[model samples]
Target: MCMAHKSCVSEADSAAAAAALFAWGANSYGQLGLGHKEDVLLPQRLSNFCEPGCIKSVTGGGGHSAAVTGRKAKPSSLLVAKNQGKTCALYITSIGSGNVDVILQRGSPWTAGVLIIISNIRRSSLLPPFMCLVCCILLLYDCPDGGSLFVCGLNKDGQLGLGHTEDVLCFTICKPLLGCPIRQVACGWDFTIMLTVSGSVFQWGTGLASSGRRLCAGQTLPLFLTAKEPSRVMGLEDSTAVCVVAGSDHSASLTDTGELYVWGRNKHGQLASLAAFLLLPQRIDARCFQDEKVTAVWSGWTHLVAQTETGKVFTWGRADYGQLGRRLESPEGQKPHKQDSQLTFWRPQSSVSLPLCCLTGAAKISCGSEHNLAVISDKCFSWGWNEHGMCGDGTESNVWTPSPVQALQSPSRILLVGCGAGHSLALCQLPALSEPCQDVKVIYTLQADTGNPESQNGMNKERNRKERQSVTSTQSNSDRTRNEGP
Candidate 1:
């Protein structure tokens, strides 16, 4: 996801640099040395995995799944596992004590929320792995239906669910979770939470979470703050979560039953309260949307946004630059509010109050460091800071009202859109499916306001927005009907 430069190594190349053909592993981290994170990697292309008779063996280890691909004309062995689903992943695989192949099973018409995690590679887990000394730590949760929610990075306090205190290098499959079938995973600084389809909750890590202890002394509520492994929450057995999102130090979970559960820091009212922080996952009420069920919820570094079935958007938390919608100013003075620069709130502010809230069925929203963007069908709408035009509203001015990007408004249908700390990008495809060679690619622009050479480049960044690139596809032969692997 680096934009400093444009270089990508294919998965095979990402392995040990196969064929040195500018493949994935060939330029791992794009010279940034961003080290390992998750999953198994072997020297093979995604095409080889799908090609008949192209794979010879597939190995499932303690926390990883790998395959040895064999090509017909020039067969070679390469351990492999192709991502079959579109979901977020936080993994780093190594061949150590873990040898559990991550599996996901579903029961009846209830689809499995297979949000799988393959390791607890805590803080020091990135020390580099040896060929024979690699280990894996993996966990699974149903995504969409009960999946996604991957947790990785530092866990020095046993916040990771590997059941041990040692930091992990590669993703080590958490063997204990194989039988539990997880629905989602949410991570706080040194803690993690897991949700199950049956409405069960399990948490791990230091702080009040490591012990799964509830502080009842000065507290009048149930606390599931600290634990070293996945522990079930006492009262959440009847709750079912449909969506989950995390901020830097706080977390939020929305249940199908029209309830919101929050925990962790709330210094700025990000958790909908005045309390400094919460050690337990407490159900916080949103007074503004009291009667409507939240359809989606998103968390920024210190802000929160929610949408209702009526296409209503509610925002709160740090609104320094109007991150909480167009509520930056007061009606009397028509200027930025008194708390606009310093105070933060957790209460939901109406989006309709803003001049651009009528999005005509706005369906989704994405947040950035201090900006926000939304999508309705093929068009995208943005608001907030325009210091570097992160709003993509065709100007470098701060905009509190949502407006569609004119540059990306036609000839093609939007396929995907993303927002980053300093830049924003969109993917589009020609609607002419009848044209076999239609191109689909990303359009990028600089949205960061860092006043440097790159910042100067931001002024001339318009040229890069029109750049188009196409990905290659694989063709199957008649003999490719049968494929085999270990």
Candidate 2:
């Protein structure tokens, strides 16, 4: 189920501005796109969406916002009738639980578009109740031409691929894509990129993995690269990828050959001793681990996690915060105990440890800002930061080892899992209504916002005003109520 905010508008100019500013969830750093650096307890109007002949879109990030707009026009026939009539078109889209209302001086506004929300789901209601909350969303679009927009990560640089640098509270189409037909899109924190069916890759946004500098702070255009010569990634020739996943500053691609290639940032050993940042993809050697057939891979800010076809997980990179889930004893004077008796007091190789033993039966995994979670068949486990009760163990302490989240100890079966900077979400298949089913419960323990209860209530009042506007119009309220998920 989903939780969202709602809004509505009546003026064209006001709608144009309102389409540019809005916020939901945590607004620390103005990431909600509300044009301010304050937390919004509830949905409130960032601006009015009553502009005539206006085209607009908005998106959200970890702590930032983005928006786009274009010229507007009225239908010629409608204009002729309005010369004797009085009516205008209103365009509206809902992202998360927040409602977006846009006014246009034209024919009927596009009724079919896409909606994206950053929220979460629970994997199992049977687990013991804990406070960990997952963040993700649903993507509803009407691209009848068989096109799809891939949504993951935040746009640190217009890289959410929504054609703007603003945080997208909802799903916005990647506009004006040309030449190669984009089959999928992926995002790193400050960058956005796309892969085409023709084996070509396009990239935009911030940071040069090679120079360690910004390639383009915020890009709206797609830049194509020829994976030949110096720009070519190793071991990708004649190979096609089936899936791609991005982390905070890195990315990974899975080939049809069951091979995995990774690129981008490597601080904290996320890239397995590749010193400098990788501008091109490099093949991962699965033979180094017991599992040779990798079925899935995931990443966090500074670490890597992957699952094999046999339900095994392998992790590398930063162990700080236990992101890697590997056991490590504090070093004694910068040296570790020697396990080999053949060596005579020799220094151990500077190598990162891999915890192949700890990650058994893990079918899926997710990484938060500083923590990690894994789903083993019907059960879920978490490690790392618990500061906001993200670990779901009902404590504010951090765990350096993997621990089962007792809060999820219900009888339902979990299907999917996701994580935000400090929160987590799971999707579970509950028992049918005819059977004994439990209500899907959501728990929030993130740092609470400091604000007067009256002020918070006032925000809700504004949200109610917007909802009333939407009801007065012909748009369906079903879009606004999608946040009530299970």
Candidate 3:
């Protein structure tokens, strides 16, 4: 997914010059689009880009990468957020024109406009070495001439929405959505969700309610689906959704009026409860927010993070990985057990306790498989799994509370931070180079400070100049003596 995934864009027009792309990190499945599968510690530039346009968005998930290209003014599709399935394969879904945009410079990889990659896995064992999964749900809002949706990757279930059971090597348009102009899309463990411009929501793919023996009466698998087509979700028939986000097994959406609805799996309180899974969209009780209007919400594999119009953050669900930003420590070295009554909260609760110390200034936040990151007044802060140094903190220690990524402080005033499975991504600004240039100027001035005797170089140069001037005057005087006084 995004851990194995990286993406970039060029502000310049490709017709005048080629768009550049840069990628680094785990590339075992060719998620980096480097022509071969290999892990790179340094950011490498990629050449496989669509000509004549600029990159709108890029997404990587489950070891696969997808990019969207469009005009600068167009409402572009969502890039991949990085999510993996049991197959352990790469799924690349480009939701724009057949052409794509991925740019990278030769020496500069962490440039401006770089989005964080998000990748994750089902409860499986065939994963890479990175701990903590970052949910890389493919959010492709592809709108071509016909504005059809396309998806490809491992399709054990019809998660690709191609109306077929086979895995596709290339993007295959969903025949069922020929004329529907989709505006937003998000993916979960094996399902895809999107909100059309007409304010309709649709979904396709497998859910646990259908995969089990007791088919939940009306739902079944090859479960919770009838065919590999984008079917309208009747549960949201009357709701006008603005955007949607898919967790590993659940989904969350916000309405134009700041209303939030959630559905699908809720095993670890992913849907706001530990009791059972949500089969359809259900409006969460207003009491969860003390009646505050919610502006946005996001779901991780087992935890949920939400934001209110007032700029406060609330979290609930799993607290095992310190993802909840709270201390769920067990005795000594013992690992925390899920469903531990004391550790697990069955309701939407406040953040890891307020006055969040280092992260008190968090403006926006996102959830990874087991970590969190946020943008705070131009700085990036993080907590949870730092096993892969994903926190950018220059250490591998797990942070139970919010902390600043000291390594990204000085030259990097981060604009955004993306948390992926066992890795983290960020978009930081390139501050003005005038500072370094000014430093050089200062050095030059010091060398010319002959007024100070301590300035050895300056003093020597002054002495040499005087000696030359004195010798010139003596030579002139001697010439006059020979021509006139003689």
Candidate 4:
């Protein structure tokens, strides 16, 4: 899977970078982006992305699905926007370096409206002539590449980020995130989490606060009490967030340093805390993950999937639907139940209770409402809810253990997999004739490289030269022995 903050160039070059998008499952609101509202039992190629290398990432929520499309733009481009009715010329330079020096001029004090500069660029510096007045409203997000965000499906709660709650019948540009170069988007039941090129995160739609709990008991609170427009998540300013993920009623963000912060509803202990709600970001205890740096994380409706550097998969939260991908243990001398629906909850009591390891060697993982998909050793494995064949097992039964999706065991290498509420999407790259089964040999590390590309190329060339020399030596030795007739 592509790292949440991967550069557009790297994403396009990836073996799994989605040249075409394939989706199956629920399409009640046309979230499938297939130009129809009918449900698809089998995976079907999305006509919208007929052009190879157009699709970057795919995500969905309760009933809406979205995809990030477009290749990386040229290194730098002059962006022109009207700020406070004064024509502003903004010269953004060195975007590919991840740190940009934005030079804006001829712009007076800003008034209403926020200008979000989204690119796949990195860190940013605001130069002279760029100023926000007392009445000016300006919001800028940075990243390194340029791309478009498209959404289709239910917008009952504005999950599509289109600035309205009307259900979308076809793929539409998310207006709020339109200008910003998006790195990726994570969808919740009624909200959306957007990550920009600059490692900034924004959220919109109804709040993710819990509906079952009152702040102090006997107190009533509004069900949807969050931003209607995209708002930056405040606490994340301290650290650059590389990845953002969302559950049915909660969300989480991961920093480049491997810190995971969670918020929203905790009714099912999805936040790893006993509190009923977390209005702000809170760090999950490292001990819960065995004190290992979590390299990646994915979420279901009420469960979470985390992978460590060692590729061990850790899971927590609701397990009734077999979403946890592990068997629940009972008290001493008591046997675990055969049926998962009645199993005890896997709530972590502080850091004392740790999340259980479901599987190992998971290179990447994606979670649906109650199902998960992982690419292990170049093959895809699935578990949990199979109703609607979201697990891609050609069955409607819930999967109790990690099982290989026979349909995905193809000659093409599985580059990445994504899951919506009741559907699945896989980004694969077919093998070239020159390199047979090269997908198995090349591991998708998904880690961002900060080194110079030229230097990397030089290293690759050196390694290839050594490999050729070794091959030639072996062949020469074989020939010499054959000539000696010994």
Candidate 5:
């Protein structure tokens, strides 16, 4: 999400940009937020977020989904005051925060405001009066003003962070994170990882597996753990992490200084270490990265993807599904190994490089259990497992190489991309039209299965006008319904 500048667009205009939510694929546990537990073959709109700029960030896990949504505070001229010898403008703005509970059982979304605090501002006389700006400006914030975590779906392992092991039928707030602002959240098979703005890491649900585990070679140990409540993770005392990633059974973090730390299951060398499992965070060997500072890291069920400041990408771990995005050459420089084979323990799994031809110049990357998505400029490319049409290429065959998602190759700018166990999500900000109107057309594209994707739907000038009217009418009825309770 990008910040809005007043010079280019007003705050109210940004807030009213109509950034909608679209989801597809597996909904067995209603993880797609589509109001029912039916598998969608193509992208479908999740009706609740159609209102302008309501959704902040969205993510999904094995059988669940979560999103952070809220309104942003606008800079306003609180008053003009005198300071020292000159008259200085005293400005103040209340940072707005809220959350919406999507009760999948009922399927209607409702908004609930959270913590509202005063944000720091420099005194200025040029500040304008109070008014709502554009939806894009506020909804795109990395950390909304006091974000609230709303989660729903299978929580039998207490992965929802609601202080209980029972499954959540509605989107409920994580009790421990009530007033605290969250920076990021990552969901694993039966656990969840959270990163706060202060860089504190939290984990909940079942911990790393305990069977046949050892800290080092020949050291027998048995350890099992579970946290129904969110617990702060240790071992990252020396550095602050800027991002966090969670695979099916492993977790990772990238520090502000560019160091990479990984923990948990190493069944397929996902930890980049020889240890079978890591109970605490351990920095990956810099030598394996060619001494380059890692810029970003993403994970799948048993593989890891990383990008360096030099624009180089490296992948390791389970490659039988082509999730590595490139071939692994044999030690003898023989022919590239087959994708269905596993990496030998002797091979330097940490140093495997993603071929430049496979992927280059990607602005962002996301990984599902066995697939990947990359957005470069205006196009989104997908590869690996597509059994559920998660690759969005209108097919169920596994994609061994990067292929463009024709539906998303449009003038609309891609804002964010996310993946789940067998589904994919892409949030796009549609271009503004030349004519003036109260609302802008925002389309949500959820990639679930294979068929002609709805994104291919053609729109002429008159059709677009009618769709805009329909959106307006829907919003109007929504507003009236809110005012006139049934």
Candidate 6:
């Protein structure tokens, strides 16, 4: 059983410096990676990252954190930046002791210039004894090398891809997947699935079709979706999938062509259907907007959201807790609206309103266990499940409609956004300015030989002087703050 997940990258890298920050929740077993067992309600920068060669990418599991860095290339000696221009490198780092284990690698043939980190966590009961076992297991995979599928966590239903349903505490290499190279893996609460470079889907873990109804509970071995029979999924054969994401009971896929497909538990209309489950992939049809194309897909515990190429956002499935971001009025409105019964199969629904329709450019989108977030034109907006202030609106009110996060107002420019079960993460881009030095005169001698007299005389000298002074003040302020430290 193989489990895989995908994340987006921010495109603001420079030759000089870079930084990565994280925040987490539910840290009973030290899974928050804060070097402590307390849950954090706000974003906190990881300690001891003041060095130059910092992190480049980060991924979070149930309770564990993983990062890829460029620090290994640099020697132990601290290389100071000349002219205040810092040279950056990458390094892999972690905190805490239990629940999950992370590994980082650089100079890979497959990814070439890319840096990758694989994170694996062993899911177990929250009891003290179980927690200790999980911690011990996390130590083994502190660092993994080469291209291999690392398996950890609950194997009760073969979700660990170990060919058995026994619990696994340590990370184990996956068996050869029928000689077919596995490019990625994804895990549901009790199931695991893999996708090959050829766009084939293989699944293992509980609730599979095998077991002759007696084994109907779950399986402990890999099962091909097209092995003995054809999958009921339509329009999947020709589509080239770029990524896959899974929820507790459902999963979603985004193709290279920007098409979205979903399957699994449909209760609460999550599958957009009236049936109980979709045994196959179902393409989401948004009507007249079919050509819009989906650039990203995020699956939550009981709901799903998709971002289109035109910056139009659409959500369907569960709306009970307002995860759909659709406004619901009382039954006594101008026209009575009937609540659709819980659906079990895949059906299409529309969520476009004035605000969403007016949105022109959306760069990224992420979904929490129940909430939804998006970075539209470098601005942040959130909706659904704000009980713990995960929406970052400075309040715990649940919003049934999309609302801009006020806490992230002026000074903070959000470069990237990520959403976890009940928490959120943001990478902010601070303004850059140079230090104030001796004011050297930038002489602009007028060319007396110019044919036009107006060209020789400086146009709007007062305006130009004022602009230069304003720029100098901003640069001086920025320099002072940088020297003072973050």
TM-score of 6: 0.62
**Least lDDT summed over 10 consecutive residues: which range in candidate 1?**
20-29
TM-scores for every candidate against the unseen true structure: 0.56, 0.54, 0.62, 0.55, 0.59, 0.62
Which model, 2 or 5, shows the larger TM-score?
A: 5
Q: What is the lDDT of residue 19 in candidate 3?
A: 32
Error of 4 at 234 (Å): 4.8
Q: What lDDT, from 0 to 1, does candidate 1 have? A: 0.45
| Clashes within 3 Å, all models in order | 78, 63, 21, 14, 15, 23
**Candidate 5, 100-164: lDDT as tens digits:** 22232232121232211111122111112211110000110122346556665556667667777
Error of 3 at 62 (Å): 4.1
How well is each residue in 341-448 modelled by candidate 6, as lDDT tens digits? 553432334222112542346676777667777776666667777655555443455666665554343344556666655556555443322323212121223333
Stretches > 4 Å off in candidate 1: 1-152, 207-223, 330-356, 384-401, 419-425, 433-486
Distance from true location, Cα of 29 in model 6, Å: 5.4
lDDT of 6 at 129: 24
Candidates sorted on TM-score, descending:
6, 3, 5, 1, 4, 2
Regions more than 4 Å wrong, model 4: 1-55, 59-185, 192-206, 209-226, 229-237, 330-359, 430-486
Whichever of 3 and 4 has more TM-score, that candidate is 3
Report the C-alpha displacement of residue 452, candidate 5, in angstroms: 16
Query: How well is each residue in 401-436 modelled by candidate 4, as lDDT tens digits?
Result: 676655444565676787766667776664433332
Q: Estimate, for each residue in 269-330, the C-alpha lDDT of model 1 and write its tens digit.
A: 67765456676667755454646667777776567788766777777666656666665444
Strongest candidate by lDDT = 5
Query: Quick one: RMSD of model 5?
Result: 14.5
